[model samples]
Each structure stands twice: as structure tokens, then as C-alpha cells.
Target: MRYWLLILPKLPANAMAIFPFILLKKASQQKDVVLINHEKIHLQQQLELLILPFYVLYLLNYFINLVIYKNHYKAYFNISFEREAYSFEGDLNYLTKRKLYHWAKFFVKSSGDRLG
Candidate 1:
């Protein structure tokens, strides 16, 4: 499916440091490309998990990891979906007909089940 990205102007300072972020104002070509790819990865994940549940699972996993890890960066990095996205986002060709469940392998396992 085709997705369009919208850029917003002036994201919160905290968000700015990590994500290039989508702004309402015009964005530079490079920023637009990166943000689009990143958000597209999120969209693909959302679709795979049936939309609503993906977000619910995301929040729950994040909090659980935060409490267990006691480190925000580690918590975020440990997220299964984010792990996959970060691992492959730089490969501009990742989104083209990528296989489902390819990312699930990157999820960090806690015991038998994977985290996030």
C-alpha cells in the first residue's frame, strides 16, 4: 500500500533529539525521506498487528521493559519492533516486498518468549 507522510513544524524538544520528526511546515528532502521511511515501517507494523493492538502492545512492552531494565534507552532499544526497524531502516530497499515476521527474529527474547 502507498502511504503519504505529513511533516509538522516544531516537535517537542525531547522528541526532536531522537526522531527527525514530521513537521507541518515544509521539510528538507533528506528529512522527508528519512521520516517517511521510518513512519512507513511503523505503519507496516501497525498493519501486521491489526492496528489498535499493535499500539497497545507497544505501550505495554515499553513499560514492562522500562521497569525491568531501569534504563529508558535500553527499554526503547529492546522493543522488538523498534529493533527491527532500526536494524533495517538504513537499507533503503527494506520496504520493498519485505517478508512478514522478518522483524520478529530481531526481538530480544526474555527466557523463551521475545520481548515486545
Candidate 2:
């Protein structure tokens, strides 16, 4: 899949991966390899799920995590997708070695089951 980057100063997060696009909070973030890799991991996850279902599952996971954690930050961090991305974001070669449905392995039942 083709990927594109856009700089949006008002983005709530440092970066976000929306299928073919990776939205960044600032232009300098484009040089942050770890940040870009994190978003790329999300892109692969979105592509694997065919986009729409990715968002649906992502939101559903967040809400379920919210109910379990009662904190937005905790909920967001515990998401299967986020877990996978954050865990491997520092590995520049992770994408080349990643397998299909790899994010599924990060799915957790509770905060105790978090990847890292």
C-alpha cells in the first residue's frame, strides 16, 4: 500500500495512522524514525484488517479497555493495536519481519496482560 504523511499542528496525538495516511503533529516528527515506525506498524494493521473493520475494532477495543481501566490513557495504551505498535516501534526492522495478524497476538484480557 502507498503511504503519505501530512503535518497538522492541531493533531491531538504525536502521530496517527489512517490507512494510507500518517498524520503528524509537526513536520519535525517526520524525522523521528521510531515515531514513523510506530505509525507504519499501525498502517500494516489497518491494511491487514481492510481499513473500516480496523477502526471499528480499534474503537471497540478502546471502549472495552475504558470499561476495564476507567482511564482514557490506560485504555488507549492497552489497545491490541497500540500494544503491538508501541512494543515494536523501536525496532526499525520490525515491519519486514512482521507476520499477518501479528497484532492479534497482543490482544489482552486485562492490564495485567499488556505486552509491555
Candidate 3:
């Protein structure tokens, strides 16, 4: 999958966790590259989930976890999809030849469904 990275003017302090868009802030050139890779992983995920549904599911899951866990950061970190993106984002060659279904391995079957 191909992904696009967008940069914005202002971002919240916790933007990395719940950015809600493609913008990344407070990053050096190298860090920006890594962050772009991270967001690219998310873009792949969004595509897998069919765009709008992905964001809907993402927000629902996150809010549910936030209500239960009472910690936004913890909730964000615990998201399996996010975990997969973060885990591999730093790999310089991740986007070069990544497989289409790689992210599916990270899904929690009971809580989430897979798409092709």
C-alpha cells in the first residue's frame, strides 16, 4: 500500500497518540521521516478498514477504552492496530516492500475484524 504524509502548523502535545489527521509536529527531519512511516502504517490500516469505517471504529474503540481505563495514553497504546504501526514504523525499509496483510497479524480477533 502507498501512503501520504501531511504536515500541519499546530499540533497538540499528545498529537502522536491521537493525531486525528496526517499532521506531525515537533519533529526533526529524521524524526519526521519516522513519523511519516508511522502515519503511513495507519493509512494502510484505514484503507483496509475502508476509510470512514476505520475512523469510526477507531474512535469508538478508543473512547470505550478511555472510559474504562481512564487514561488516554494507555488506551491509545493498547490499541492493537496502533501497536502494529508503532512497532514497525521506525524500520527504515518498512515501506519499501511491506506486505498488504501484514497488519492483520496484530488484530485482536475477538475485538476486531479483518479486511482485504
Candidate 4:
């Protein structure tokens, strides 16, 4: 992952994946494996989508959810990619067992809660 640690971003998230890169809100969080694992999940998804399409789809989903929930935080939390990443971020070896396009399953179920 192409890491870029800085201050705050436009979004409310502490870290965000931009395909090959991960933009972190704080440089100190670099050693936080759980957070890195979370972003890594996003990297896998971005890779599967070949980058550009991933961002397009992500924005589409976020906008759709934003309309549905009428809440930015709720919309972001419900995004399929975020849902999938948040689900397995805690499992450091999740990348090994994860199936290709695993985020697809999230569209069928409500992936609970938000994680940093």
C-alpha cells in the first residue's frame, strides 16, 4: 500500500483508501495493525476493481446510501466496501481466507457498526 500520513481529510474518516494509497489522518497510527489491516482490505477491493472503477462504485454507493439514510455517517458506514473491510479488519489473516469480491456479500446484509 502507498501510505500517506497527514492531518485531517475532507471526510470524517480517520483513514481512507485511494486504491494504491492509504491516506491516514495521523502519522502515529501507522503502527496500528488493526487500522492497517482495515485499509488493506480496501486495497484488495480496489485491486479487484482495477482502481478507478472502485472509486466510482464507492462514490455511487455512498451517494445512494446518503439518499436512503439522509445521513453522511450512516451512508459511509453502510457502503459495501466499508462494510466488508470493517467486518474483517480485526482479523489480521483475513486477507488469506477472503474470497475475491467479498464485498458483494455486504449488499445483501447490513454490516453492523463503524470502525476507525
Candidate that would win on lDDT: 2
Model 1: weakest 10-residue lDDT segment is 13-22
Top-down TM-score ranking: 2, 4, 1, 3
Q: What's model 1's lDDT at 68?
A: 75
Weakest 10 consecutive residues of candidate 2 by summed lDDT: 107-116
Alpha-carbon shift of residue 5 in model 4 (angstroms): 6.3
Question: Per-residue lDDT of 1-116 in model 3, one digit per residue for the tens?
Answer: 53334444476642343334565554453356676677777777777677787778777767866775678886776566676788898896886677775755655544334221
Best by TM-score: 2
What's the residue-level lDDT of 72 in candidate 3? 80
lDDT measured at residue 40 in model 4 versus the true structure, 0 to 100: 87
Clashes (backbone N, CA, C under 3 Å), per candidate, total 7, 0, 0, 0
TM-score of each: 0.71, 0.93, 0.67, 0.83
Residue 111 displacement (Å), model 1:
7.7
Higher-ranked by TM-score: 2 or 3: 2
lDDT of 4 by residue, 33-91 (tens): 99989998999998999989898999999998888788888888888998898889999
Q: Give the TM-score of candidate 4.
A: 0.83
lDDT of 1 by residue, 6-110 (tens): 445554421121122323344463365554565567678877777777778777877987987788887887777777777676777788867886656765455
